[model samples]
Each structure stands twice: as structure tokens, then as C-alpha cells.
Target chain A: MRSLTAPRRDPAPSRLSYRLQRLALTPMVRVAVRRGLPLLALLLVLAVLLGDADRRAVLTDRIADLRMQIQQRDEFMVHEIRIDGASDLVAAEIGRALALDLPVSSFDLDLEALYDGVARLDAVSRTDLRVRPGGVLEVRVVQRVPAAIWRGPTGLHLLDADGARVALLPRRADRPELPLLAGEGAERAVPEALRILDAARPIAGRIRGLTRMGERRWDVVLDNGQRILLPRADPVPALERVVALDAARDLLDRDVAAVDMRNPARPTLRLGAATALRLRNIKLTELGVD
Target chain B: MTDLYQSQRAMRAMRRAAMQRGVIAILDVGTSKIACLVLRFDGPDAFRPSEGVGPMAGQSAFRVIGAATTRSRGVRFGEVSAMQETERAIRTVVQAAQKAAQLRVDHVIACVAGGDPRSYGLAGQVELEQDHVSEQDVARVLAACDMPPIGEGREVLHAQPVNFALDHRSGLNDPRGQAGQMLACDMHLLTVDGTTLANLIHCVKRCDLELAGLASSAYVSGISSLVEDEQELGAACIDIGGGATGVSIFMKKHMIYADSVRLGGDHVTSDISKGLQVPLARAEWLKTRHGGVVATGMDDREMIELGGESGDWERDRRSASRAELIGIMRPRVEEILEEVRARLDAAGFDALRSQQIVLTGGTSQIPGLDGLAPRILGQQVRIGRPLRVSGLPEKATGAAFASAVGLCLFAANPQDEWWDFEIPMDRYPARSLRRAVKWFKDNW
Candidate 1:
């Protein structure tokens, strides 16, 4: 007799599982499930995290804190400022102008603002600022050289060749070697004044300074109170002619109050009052009318 | 008849669509197992023919990309007896094949093994209207063939134009562009039980697959197992499957006749099961491992362990001699071969020019079948295996996969069937646009 038992298990898959397997084998469905699912999950996570305003603020704050921590590292600190090509006073002035505390983070140091501040100093002509490695702020400066002195109503100020003011002088002896310019707008015409002084080097011992008359012409004053009024167009040539006359005839040694050469074609001399009375008596005696 | 032609034409169209998609499936619903093969068509220009090589038996056109087989259930005599169980089996096999191929195949070409196929020879003659025979004349000649009374509840599986002859010149393979007065042709028609065909189509449909093409198992097995010259001359293929034996005769590379016997290796296994008082599973194992048709003195000395799972240890330990196993299997194998012989004789296979008979299928693997087949089948009987196709798994290149491999070849390059040719415009009804167009052309 056959034994009563259950039948063997079938190896075939159920209809549902079979269809599911076929569905999974489809290329479009497989790619969607395999690749698209993970990407979608990542995007969903990102969206969820970024959708809340509080969470967004926290993320931004965290990023900013991280940046601040990196910026505050000791490696990025600027300890000392090395100012080059500046005199002692200008260097001190530049340091005071920048007003940056040492050992401050270089990231906090605005080089452009600092450069503009240092350049604003009357003594500094061009400034370059950079935060070098190893905690050093290097301030490279080009200082303006005093080319002439202008004695204005306020005081005497030192001016560069381009008529750019460099510094102030307390007295005229402070820069004795420099040529002096006095009167209004003299600082603007310092180049022309320096050229006239250059032409009057023949009487350099007798010349005192130059005065800009009416802000147009120049009057070259000698130490003996004699003055030569120069034409405005070419004052250097007029000054050169006066120097030649003084050299040939000792014209500057006589009692002439002023020599007027405003017109290059003609010349005039104004005598002093005492010299004029003496010259009239000498002329009457010579003509026999005592 | 028109319904059959239209259905066949629809299937051919489906096949063309599958070919354009580059992938199709081959299914063999056998009794013992249902096999599925995924074939990728690379087209004709995919590979260059070698210096001395041809198309390699038409196997070069396609490659076996995926293959799967499952133990058949709810199937008997190669027909689905239990619908639900068979559907599950098909789903399992098709899913596995798709998994292996990593592709979803929507089109399938299936073969039926136990459909009780019957073959008929039809002849017709027509007078050529023009000096030269055109394609219309060929279609007219084919349409002139009278339909045989194939009886009720039967459907035609294959209707192939076998021979075309012009007047005074017979054996003309192509009558087109030939100067002939009378054009005669012979066509081969194979029909099977209508319900069986319906069952197969419904089964494939349930699996969400379109039936692109349908072939008789006997006809396809012959296509795979028979060599080129054998097919070119004449041959017969006897496929000894599980529940049915398929017998097909081929002449001039066309299946001239096809039939099936409803007896096969399953009956032999049942005979062994009954004779040895063993279970069907154990009987099947014995049939494959040690079964043979010819028993000798050495077979008697060889003993096989016929172990049983019964609780009684004595019954479980029982053994049988190889000769006894062979004794139970020989008669059934002879009966199947005799049935095949009767089929061949009835089809007048002996009248062909060459009388080569090839034995194939799952049961043909018996060790002594080569020795026993000659006595029943002719003197030229040979046990054959399927043709070698590219990328076929080594395990599936056996006699049992003959029909599956042939289905691949059929999917790649199908022979011209009657529906493949266009019908004469006059054959259409008066309402058809083609008839009106032809009318205008003739008058103008």
C-alpha cells in the first residue's frame, strides 16, 4: 500500500512573484529603482533639512563660525608692521594713521583701507600695504622729498617738485638750502619760482627770495632791498638779464629801489628818496644853477 | 480558410516587429519540461563570412543570449491539462529566461508537440495571363489549389508552397519571370487540433506574451537535426519526446509531411514504474541513468540500486538488475519507434530520393538507441543532436533541445508560407480598394 504523505514542494514561483520578477527585470523600472531611488532619497533629505528657517539659520551660523575659527588661527595673525622708505616722522605718522593693534588677525586687517590711510599723510607720496607670511604686515612707502619752501600767511610749508605739500616748517632757516617762495598762490608756482632762483644763481649771494606779485609776476629781492620786477611770460629770462646787469655794472650795489622789466622791450629803475635828492643836487651843480 | 490566412499573416507581422526590435523568445512546451530560449537577432550584416565559410546553417543570424528550462507540471501528452499549473510553469521559465537575458521579451515563438498534427499535399494549375510569370501568377497558382476537407475542429499550422513547375518543365523551384503557358504548384499543409492551438495561444497570452509565430514540434525538430544535404535530398526526423513522438519527413528543404504519435518516453517510464513497483520519480531517474533498449549478458550482471523512500528499510534497500530495467523499457521504446514507422510509411517517405532518418529529442539519448533504431527505422537511422548555435549553454546542447534550437532558426529566417505571398487582387471582394485599383490599371 502507498504511504499517505503530502506531495513534494513545487519549485515554480507563484504567479505574483513571477510577475514581480519580470517587472524588476524591465530596464526602465530597474534603473528607476536602483539609481533614481537613492538620488531621490538624498534630495528628499536635503529638502527636509533646508525647508525650516530655523535650521537654515543654524546651518549658516555654523558655517560662519567655522570660517571665524579658521580666520582666528595664530598663523594668520599680523604681529609687527615694517614701514619701508619713510622717514622717522612719516613712519610714526603712518603708524598712527593706520591705528592697527599688533597681533591682530590678518584677515581682520583691510589692506586697501590701510593703504589709503597711510597715503593720506602729507609726507607719504605712494603707499603699498601687504600682510606678509609669519605674522608681519609690511607697509611699503615712497616718501615725498621737499623741493621748495613757501612762506604763506599761515606758516612756512615744504612743497615737493610737483607742488605737492610734504610738511610744514617752523622757520625759514629750517631748510636753508631750499629756495623760498612767498605770497599768495606761491605754492602752486613753486616750479617757476625755483626756475627763477636757478637763473639768479650769479647773484646768489645778494638774492634774498622771490615774491609773486599779483599772483602773476615775480619780484626777485636782493639782500640790499633792491627788487627786479620780471615779466610774467618769461620771468626766467628777465631774471637772467638782471643778473647780467648786476654782474657787469654793479647795478644791484647802487641805491635803486626797484628795476621794472615787466615789458621785455623796455626797462625802468626807481631810485630811493635820498638817492633821488642827491642825484638832483649833483645834476644842478653840473648845470651851474646852485 | 481566409480566417486562417489572416491569422497567419498577423503572426508573420508580429514576427517582423520582433525582428525589428532585435530580440525574440523561443518556447518549447514539451511534456517533460518546458524550455525557453532568448535569441538576440544581430541582423545579417553583424558578422562577416569567413573565406571558406557560409552562414553556418543559419545559426549565425542569431545568438542564444539566455536559456532556461523547468520541470513541466499540469501538462500531459504535451498539452496543458491543468491551466493554472501550466501558467505558473510558463511564468517561472519565462521570468528566469528574462532574468538571464536581462531583457523583457514581449514576443514569443512557440512550438507544440502533441497537437495530433496531420499533413496534406495540395496541387493546383493555372494559365499564365502574361507572357512571363509574375508574382501575381504565382499567387494565383497558389490560390488555385483546392482545400482538402480537413474535417471539423482542426486548424492549419503550416501551408508552404513546396514545388513550382512551369509547363513542359517540372521541378522548377521558381516560376517567376519564367516563360511558361501553364504554371503548376504543389503545397504542403499541416493541420492540428483547433482546441490544442487555442490552449497554447491562451497560455502564452496569460503570460503577457504575444504569440509571434507557431510551429509544429515535428517540423522544427527536423529542421534542427537534419543536415543540409539530407534536407536538400530527403529525410525523416523522429523526435522521441516525453509524452509524444514527433515524426516529420523533409524533402528539398521543406517539410513534406508531419505527424505525431501520442506515445513517448513518459509511457516507457510508466511501464518501468509499474514493472518494478517503483515510484514515477525513481523510474524516471532509472530511465535516464541506466535505461537501454538492448539488453545483453553484461546488463544482467549489472545491478542498480532501486532505493525507495518508504519507511520499511527492506523495501528501501531493494535493488534491480540493469537487464530487468531494460526489459521493462525496451518494449515501450519499440512501440514508440513502430508508431513512428507507421507514420513514416503512411506518409510515403520511402518514395523520396534519399531515405535518411534522424532520431532526436530527450529519449533518443538512450545508449543503445543507435543500435536498436536501425531495426525498426530504416538502415540509415542515426541518433542526432541539435545544430550548434552561438552562445548556447553547454548543458542545453543536447538532443532534447532540438526543437528549441530549430525555433531559433525559424525566428531568424522563416520559410515562405502561403500567407507570405500576396493574394491575387481579383480574389478579394469587390469592396476592397486593391480590386478597384487593379480594375483601373487594367482598363487604362
Candidate 2:
């Protein structure tokens, strides 16, 4: 209901609140204040809360523990090595070459480097290394086959058909049945020397060994103290021709100390000591000029 | 007609938009200070069954995320006097609050005072469309309420259906989903000076903001300051502001009547300035620091020095006793209280079962007002502050922010108004004459 009394009225008045308002933080003032003082206060509080060394140590220990647990999981830890396709000697050499401690974590093992190292042994041609289940590390080794014996200054080394060294022996008698090669580069022409040995199998009883000539050719030696010079290129064909002549005329059995076949087109033979002496006396008497 | 519809639509749209965004700002535009508070509303999904039991029923849970208050300017007696200046001031506090909240808000629900708001109770009855009364029946009953003849230069600010009666059963709050042949409603309508609202709307618009909703500061102050029991029974909240004292009566959790006494804290300051012959600023400081109505025997010995650098020796060193300062402030405060008492009495406040009176607002800080208010207003008086809200700045959560906080409650659980529903165009057939009759019967 409307009343007779008017609301007691007054003129508007200005206030001291304005001065108080001026002291308040406007965004403009807050920007500067936050940069200088308030920001530092906030950071100081945070430092007090988070900079405790005890908490840091606990956190760091927890992180290290987690890392170790991941690394030492049982799924792939390599406790032992299983070798396949290897003889006892080859496996022993490979074990020495590997140089790994048993019961090692598989994560720490470098399988590629292990394969290369184990395969570089004299008896091993290739290797397959893997960490199988049940914490076992398996090394599959393939040992090279010895094709011939090479008499080097170091020792009597067994060689494969490709002239790679397989193993070292104490003496030549250790492998008497294998054909032997002696010289600086005899290992380099192992295939050619083996081919020559095959061609002279018809006189196998008289054959001794093959020697390298300046790394360019081969000289076949006989137990009868004869030597045959073989050409470097096409040495197999030249040796085949010698075998043909030996089959037709028993050329290898005559008293010839040396048959030089370096020039395939012209063949020559040096007489033995007795044959040369008898031939010299007859020629001197006939010519009366000795 | 279109203006009313459009304005109502605009307000409703803003409510929708604010609800969709789940955050809005409440602004209390007063003479002494302008306050802005940003509220974060947890949406419908955020409500708990435990929530529906309080005074804030069906209200979204909200927190005061940002708050900023500054000295008001270009406003007198709770009305904007200078357009540009008020716009700038509104922009200032709103921007500051937005910065604090780290968000931009377009919707604001504002509260104003000293707008000459008038309240009237209108009754209506309508035939139900079906056996089971629906929301439409309630709407029809409210529409059937006679729109009275409020004079020129006045606008309807609030139209809330205070009570509803269905057929044989009366005192029904909601008739929906109930079988009834007849529906009835008792609606309370409030109107204010049209220019007072237009000025605020234009000022808000000039600030490049939307006028989402507007409320009477007196009504909102009661909403936040009065306790649940006080509101449920009968109580009045007297908000003694800077330029005006706002008075509102509430019963059953709704405002039944509201009036304003246009003298407030500033008047007391003026009295001190005139009595002591000091600057207005110094008088305010004295009022806040040393002014009080309840003078003790030792008050005669306590002296306040008025120091100044004006270079006038006698004026610079003048001193006054605390008793003398209280002597000057008490009368203006008493006059405002007496005026509020008269208005409350005229509203039949004493006839209500509970006549508890609550004093809140900036000026309510005067010491001994609780004792002084009871004797002068002749009621059970108590000083009230707004209920606590989360994250509210320590300073802003005081009694001065009652209306600002109340605006948040009003925005959260806004009492449904007539404009929210579609009214038949012909329903307002007897608008002016009936309103004149109602006004004459109530006042004369």
C-alpha cells in the first residue's frame, strides 16, 4: 500500500572509499606486482614444499628399482649357451672366442658381435646365436672342413679348399694323407695345387708336394727328387698334358731331375746326375775336345 | 504490447543462455559502491537429492569464483544520474571481476534501489481445460489475474503468483497433474518508475553488455539476508544503503511488500560533515572509524582530531568528542528507520505472525544498530549478513554484499514470473482502469 510519508531523502555524497579503491590491485598493477614480489612469494612457497631432499631420495630410489626390475625379467635372461653343429674342439674354441660370463642377462648381450667373433675361429665357418626360452643362450656353430695341409713358417696349418686356415698342427705327420703345399703364397693357389695333385694321381707314389713360385705359378715336386714347373693360367690343362705324356711314355719315371713346363709350347727336361755324367763322357770321346 | 513481449523474451533468452553456459555474473548497482561477482553454476547434473531440501530448491549449486567492488560514481539514490559515467563504472568492476575469474561474461543479473517500486496483490480464477489440471491451467489462472492500471512512466518489474487454489481445494501451490474443475491464483505484481529501468538498461547496453535480468535491491537483500525461518514465516529486511534505505517484507519465502527510505549511510556522513564542518571525505573516515550511536560514559573523554594540511590553523587542529559525533549521526539514521517502520506498518507488517526485522547492507555496520533499531522500528531486530559462499573474497563477504549475493540466489532459483508463460492477448482487457481501481483501493 502507498504511504503518506515520503522516503527521507538526501543529496548524493562522495566517499573515502575511492581512496581505498586506489589501494586495490587492478590488473595493471597486478602485472607489475606479480612479476616482482607476488611471483617470488609463490616460488618461495613452492620451494619450501617441494625441495625436501628426503622426498627426492625416495623418488629417485623408486625409479632405479623400476628400471632394474625391467632389465632382470626372467623371460629373456641368458643362463646357459647351447651349441649345435660343432665338434668338441670347435665348440671349445668358440667358447673361448665368445668370452661371455654364464648366467648373464640377455639384454646385455650383443648377439651380432657374438656371431662375428665365434665365426672368426679357425674351425668355425658360420654361426647362429640366439637367446631361447627358459633363459638359455644358444650358439649354433658350423666348423670348416680341412682339405689340405699348408706348411707355413708358423706351423703345419690345416686349410680348407678355399685356402682358409682351419687349424694348426704340431707336425706334418699329424696329417700325412693330405696333400701338402709349401711357399709364401701357397695358400693363395690352393685350388690350383689341388687340381695338379689330382692330375698327377697316376704317379701318386712318386709325388711329394707342391710349391709356389713367386705367388704367380706352382712347381710340382716328386719324392723321386724331380720337379715340374706348371703355368699359372690354365695350369690344370698343362698338368693334364703332363699326365697324358706320362700315361703314353712313362715320362715321369725317366731320370730327369726337372721338367720345366712354364712355356707350354716348348717342353724341356734336365738329366739326372748319373745320366749327365754318362752322356758327357761319350760326347767328349767322340768330339776329342774335353 | 510488442515492447513488453520482446523485453520479456530477451530476459528469458538470457536466462536460457546463462543456464547453457553454466556461469553468469551478478551486479549490485548501489549509490556508495558497485559490486560484481562471477558465479560458477554446476549444471542440472551437479545437483544432489540432498540439495532439494533447502531454501534454494531446484537451484543449481554455485560458487563465487570472482568478486570485485569499487566506489560507485554518477549514481544517486540507487539510480543512474549520468549515463556515460555509470556505464564506465559498470565496465570497470565487471572487467576486473572477469579478469579475476579468467573469463568473459556477457550476461549479468543486476539489482537496483530507490526506483519507487509499488506492489499489488491480484487474484484470478479460470476453468480447467481438462479433469487433470495442467501447467496450462496454472498459466491461464495467472493470466486471468487482472492486470491493473499502473500509471504512465511506470513499468512492471515483477509478477509472481504468490499462491494457487484449485477448485474445492484452496491454498494450492501448484495445480498441475491434479484433477480439478477450477483453478485460482493470487499473484503479486510490482512496478517501478519506467525511467529508472530505462536508464539502467541503456547504461548496461552502452557498456556493450546485455541486461539479462533486473531485480529490486530491496527484494534481493531479503533473499540473502533473511534466514530460512524468517522468510518462511514473516520478516522484513531493511537494507540501509548509501543514498537510500531499501525495505522488503517476505512471508512463505516470497516478497509480499517492498518500499524504500531514500536516506542512507551517506546522509549520516553528510550530517557529520555539516555538524563538524569538515570535508565529506574526512567525515566518511570519521563515520567508519569512530562514529557509533551507542555512546558510553567514556565517550566524552575520547576525542577525534581532524587533521588537515589546508594551512588554516584553527580548522586543521579542530577536535570533537565521540559523543558529539554520535549525536550528529543518530538522528539521520533514526529518521530512515522511522520512515522504514511507517512503510512496514502501512504494509500490514505487524499483522503478520512473525515480525522479525533484519538490518543489512553497508550502512548496517553502524554499531549498536541492533539495539537502536528495535526501539525505533518497534520490532525484533537483528543485523544480518549474506550466507557464506565458496571462494568469495574475505572483504566482499560482509553485510555490504547482501544484495550482490542475493542476486546470485535470484539468478539461481528465480521465482517463476508471469512473463515466462504466454498470456492471451485479450486477457489484459481491463489493464489501466482496473489497475487504477486497485491502486486507489490499496493506497487511498
Which candidate gets the maximum lDDT versus the true structure?
Answer: 1
- Give the per-residue lDDT of model 2 (tens digit) for A98-178: 899877778789988998898778788878888888988788877788989999988799999889999997888878889
The second chain of candidate 1 has a TM-score of 0.96
First chain of model 1: TM-score?
0.82
lDDT of candidate 1 over B205-249, digit per residue (tens): 999899999999999999999999989889999999999999999
The DockQ figures for the candidates are 0.52, 0.02
lDDT of each: 0.90, 0.83
Q: Each model's number of backbone clashes?
A: 0, 2
* TM-score of the A-chain for all models: 0.82, 0.77
Over 4 Å off in model 2, which ranges?
A1-290, B43-60, B422-444
- For model 1, the stretches where C-alpha displacement exceeds 4 angstroms are A1-5, A64-290, B44-55, B170-181, B312-314, B430-444
Cα DockQ of the candidate 2 complex: 0.02
Candidate 2 overall lDDT versus native: 0.83
lDDT of 1 at A62: 100
